[model samples]
Target: MRIKDAGDMTSKAQETTAAVSRQRHRGQPYVGQPMERLEDAAILTGRGRYGDDLGVKPGTLHAAIVRSPHAHAELGRIDATAALDAPGVHAVLTGADLVAWSRPFVVAVKAPMEQWALAMDRVRYVGEPVAVVVAESRALAEDALDLVRVTYRVLPPVVSIESALDEDAAILHPGVGANVVSDRRFRYGEPEAAFAAAPHRVTLTAHYPRNTCTPIECGVVIAEFLPGDEGYDVTSNFMGPFSLHAVMAMALKVPANRLRHKAPRDSGGSFGVKQAVFPYAVLMCLASRKAGAPVKWVEDRLEHLSAATSATARLSTLEAAVNAEGRILALSYDQIEDCGGYLRAPEPATFYRMHGCLTGAYDIPNLLVRNRVVMTNKTPTGLVRGFGGPQVYFALERLVQRIATQLGLDPLDVYRRNFVAADAFPYRAAAGALLDSGNYQLALTRALEDGGYDELKRRRDAARAEGRLYGIGFAAIVEPSVSNMGYITTAMPAEARKKAGPKNGAIASATVSVDLLGGVVVTIASTPAGQGHMTVCAQVVADVLGVNPADVVVNVEFDTHKDAWSVAAGNYSSRFAGAVAGTVHLAALRVRDKLARIAASQFGCTPAEVEFADGRIARHGAPEFALPFARVASNAPHWSPQQLPAGEEPGLRETVFWSPPNLEAPDENDRINTSAAYGFAFDMCGVEIDRATGRVRIDRYVT
Candidate 1:
């Protein structure tokens, strides 16, 4: 489980590749080099600090939220008098109290539903928090919650996307008129003509089920209101898009400066699950303010499972317009995603994330996609790993297989015909994502060869001859990264987007500072969910600065107060490799440039003529003409200011931000890159379904 070096993993992968007759040559070290992770030992040895491990002040009260048992209900009355009299119970808070103390949570998407930390007026989901109990201990808080009775007039629930979309369905949010929250269509190229002129047309439909990552540690929050500064100091186990500072501040009716969020040094895991923890953060802050003391709440398994956000479930229909030879000319998609009870901040993000990859690995020149968001009586859905890609590819790839079946063509052959040419990149997808680089055909061919595709087919035919059932399925997907922050604004109308002003790009920030002793420290905005972020940071910085990976330190904890962050910051959206790594490299390069200049002065050479290698600066191709990197780094912080390079800053420090090139604002067409780089995964899964026991055994998966 401990990743020693970048090569450590490469060696194992090479062994596997060699077993499959795919051995390749090794390359340079550092960024692509192997190195052991520094964070693993502390984590594996039980020294990590997770959410529940942190506690508030001595007299801090504990809280337990009372959630709605009914999916749809009208609020009648809440009786908390008995709970206030319970043992050790300090106070019981209801929607009425929150109404006086706070505003509804902010919704980033242009949906009509108004959401609050605690449900008020009516409950739309089964686990909506209706009230809260605060006490000296968690046990007392639980007891107090039971004593506080809430009366509800239960109403019919809109439980499914189909039911919610019914013409006669009850509107989940009263003013929205229908369960539909947002609906729009986007088209690229001549889709109508392409479908009309095509000799072949294929369609596929499927429902991607809703799921959530059950992180080992559930949501926990501790908030202390500093009345002296009129600000709040909150510590929680949450991977934040520090931009939430403004969102939570707005909900609390305080200025953004009054709120600060910090994460523990270690988190169990968040593959997008922690995105939903913000609402609870504001709730705990309210509890603290109401009780006039710090407050803490640790969610139990039941609460976590029933209330936490999930990956949005989607129902999709995909169509392809193809030539007589099976080359796709156009693609179309009509999809309805269940947003659950509320369109929380960034709810509709799942729908638009794959806008650029709608055509998948194809070079379809014409495309159209119609997306609709629906609200149902379930937990709200937000970000998850592979958030939108899985659902989109499920439908798109299934269509690819169906096309092959109908046309009597090999699936791989059909895919090969449609793939974007290797040299065609940076090719623009029909939608608008300017794909940076890829060799789709090369990748697919290698995968087929390595997975023994031909051999598998032979085995399948032999099995069928013996009256055994076997099948293999193929799916091609484009995984997008470096989430464009401006893409979310597409949910708003053109006028609204314009009123919002010039759009910001998808950006990530990193700070690199060199110590007088020549050590490097990198602080990034991203928090790790055991993803070896520290290891990657070390590798990238060490490679850029000409130092050992072990010598470069990475600050893994994401504290909004300490990190150089942006609105696009967070661990979601598959952004690290494209955005974070690039930012870290840029920052490190700045530091390295300064070091080179200082070393050049000492070595009596021009900066451009000097090279940094083995932690020393020397004339290019001359190892003897060198200055130790440490001696040069010391000049910035320890040397007399007069001796510093002219026009150079005083410290060997740099902070840089990165945004993808060729990024454009969403036009009236609602088209955008959505992500900077597109990483493709071609998967072939072999499985056996045992009809007797109805069990599925996955025999092999090649990606």
Candidate 2:
């Protein structure tokens, strides 16, 4: 029934899937084919292992944090005596105690601020940790939290972006002097000149509400500090890039190699929520080191929602310059982003991720953007699906609609007029984003057809004539994948960047190996958040090796100590479909190429003469002149080494790294290709409003 309902509304998706099925049936398996998820049985049947499911030694301790009730407050005193006397309680740790043992967390983007495992001298936001209580069980830990007494001197809270940016607002970070942490302006072409020449202009302002990626399971971490030469081992349900291991090590004041970070095979969900779990990873590591035993901390629902990060709230003003025909000539945006409390490692990414996508799907030749990152008494912002794309498009698309309404023109016609043409392959946007490939018009046309746009418009007009409120809106959005890390460098000034040198690009790595039985094994750095990464990986490998998907084993473990990882490796930025898949394909190809060479040597033909067919290595027009993959695979590792081809290693294993070539450092102007591939999504929403209650009901939504 669920599938039927989904298919009823998703006709275009079904058509794409059918096309892929036809391609797979023609013997081009995988890549485009839709394969069944390999993890469903293990996950649904209760066989999956999550972070909280990890068991430690019998002496392991559980920790609970005492958090601040006030949004902004000075730390006066913390009385842990009563908590220490609680039954089963082992130790009580305060922020000052942890401060003496650990250094401040490392910042990815340079902002004048300090972030630590616990709030040291003051609490900037509600639910900020002040003390931690460790006990024998989770229940005892929770019970002891109530006994910990904390005194605070409340201060005025800057709750909103406008208030945070006010002249009289109190500084959140004294070192920064103001609530604004980072501010910058980026412009391309002659925006002022183009605006002057345009005969029509429209301005729009929007306030995007703050929201969060609330996963079913909250943050959980288990940390153990081994004695003597052995270091710390921390396990979590963290879907990560694992580059955070260095940051955590810096906070712990230990060698980066000493902190071994491991993630469970499965996490309930991330949608970018679990990236913020690293600070808790460090906090629990501190708890375990102080307690002299493994320690576990699992965040409850209230704590997760109140304290965990959120997508930054934005206040934006967009101005669009258009010709008489509704073709946009110039665009400008002024935005203020509310980044709560401290600027976490990647908090402000939600503002800069779409630097290239600021113009949406338009061919506007002139553009300007100014972003002010303001600190407020709210949970720090972090990664979420769509990142900053939706925010920019919301303002721009709304402005486009207003222009049509004000000019008495069709909104759809206005979008078609401004769209970047299909022939503009690798089109460079005004903001310097290289749109690798997309057909915006085709996507829009398909959406209109799929959603019955004409019929919907008629119904909406008829409803409006009857004194009922009904409206439809359209948006053309460019979805980018594989973010270039260099985009963040733009947050700093050009003078600062000149001193720091160049920065750019994202990289993904994968390792592929063939066992003695000819079974394929693949390992990548990505941690899956229920995305079926393992299934897709196996299908790609099986396609390349001419074998069944069942014969391919894709290891989805994200262990910094073992996997082939780089700082740029992760599941964020929609990278799996572009960079990660390409990396895996490259690694698998290297192994397949070697296997072909070995088979060619046995067949007494050159490497180019060998071809893959029906799970066997064969020569052209010779069905019987083929060698079983098992026979070829065993020759290298298990058989004699002298039998191998010249300059070929006697193993069927290879590791490869892939990075997009288009990424380049920002020039004199703060502009660069922020991503690799640019895909377009056309969305139309029909909404009806109740005038009395100010309630909005979505009549229909098509994407």
The model with the greatest TM-score is: 2
- TM for every model, in the order presented, reads 0.92, 0.94
After superposing candidate 2 on the true structure, give the runs of residues whose Cα lies further than 4 Å from its correct spot: 1-26, 693-695
Which tens-of-lDDT digit does each residue in 404-440 have in candidate 1?
A: 8889998889989988999998888887787888899
Model 1 regions more than 4 Å off: 1-28, 609-611, 615-628
Compared with the true structure, what per-residue lDDT tens digits does model 2 show for residues 27-57? 6676656655666546654667777787788
Residue 376 CA displacement from its true place in model 2, Å: 0.8
- Looking at model 2, residue 132 earns an lDDT score of 87
Model 1 scores a C-alpha lDDT of 0.81
TM-score of 1: 0.92
Against the unseen true structure, what C-alpha lDDT does each candidate score?
0.81, 0.83
